[model samples]
Target: MATLVAGANAALTAENPGLDHVVVGMGWDTIPSNGPQAELVPFALMCDASGEAVSNDHLVFFNQLVSADASMTFVGDGDQEQIDVQLGLVPAEVTKIIFLAYVDPEFRGQGTFASVRSAHIRVATAENRELVRFNLGTDHLDSVTAMIFGELYRHRDDWKFRALGQGYSTGLAGVAKDFGIAL
Candidate 1:
């Protein structure tokens, strides 16, 4: 059974029995009349205790599918994107993973989340059991070119997920910069 949660600060632990991995899935529909089709690219940053990316190698996306320690991976493409995390594989130096979606810059000038019929970010198990989900819909400001959907962070010796739902007009680059990525 999955827990439905809301707000940026809401948190939940991945304490389900036999759970060793969590998949962060993002999905969206394109609005036919919204100029050229846009891609909602999903990515994640492995951050340390201070919320800064540990290194460029920790940026997982289409071009870079896996993290340095094999703890994180970006899978799938197009309207549906996913990030897989191995709870036990993450390095102790790392403390958080921020899951986000961005409107490809190539399509940003003409499209935005407003053109998305519906979108959502979900956390689930390897066996396909949903743990939690957050809807990122047209209600968002049209100027938002990127979104920080949620985050998985360490709380004590356990892992927890927080619903972020924050928007960014600077797109993916902005997010990368905010997380301490050089470029």
Candidate 2:
């Protein structure tokens, strides 16, 4: 599998022809600390060409768990969630799907990336064959409350993936506002 850094792009379809489905997985290690550890939650935002959610129900996470067209859904395993997306089945209006993680504000645990040691996001086939991986460097950003790990976007008739590794201090609400998501 190819390892990518922030801003690197991979053409998943070109790399492996006839690939119709993939599992986007994210996992992290947290620093040991007293009291509660940070509760990190993974989510995906299905957006239009303008990079905003096409609708209020276009978010897929632990709460909603699925997208409107059934193109994206979460498969819980271990302490992380694997996202499954049927590329061809995704609505044409949807041009991008951004994968992100946030320290759940509602959770009683520490709500920041200060407790995260290391993290990674990867794409694999339905059979668990990893295609590409991006190891996010979470070093020194103690105030970060939300992070954008990667994204899958439409390139003409094909789909491509990019590593982001961007962080936010305003928490998930800031991310929601920027992406036009209704909470």
Distance (Å) between predicted and true CA of 93, model 2? 1.0
**Each prediction's TM-score versus the true structure:** 0.87, 0.95
After superposition, the stretches of candidate 1 with alpha carbons farther than 4 Å from their true spots are: 3-5, 8-14, 34-37, 76-79, 107-110
In model 2, where do residues sit more than 4 Å from their true spots?
A: 76-79
Which digits, one per residue and each the tens of the lDDT, describe model 1 over residues 1-183?
444445644344535655668888888787776364556777888899888999999888878899988998876543288888998999998998888888886753545666766677788777667878777546755788788888888888778777777888888778877889887
Model 2 is weakest, by summed lDDT over 10 consecutive residues, at: 72-81
Assess each prediction's global lDDT (C-alpha) against the native.
0.77, 0.87
Clashes within 3 Å, all models in order: 0, 0
Task: Give the number of colliding residue pairs in candidate 1.
Answer: 0
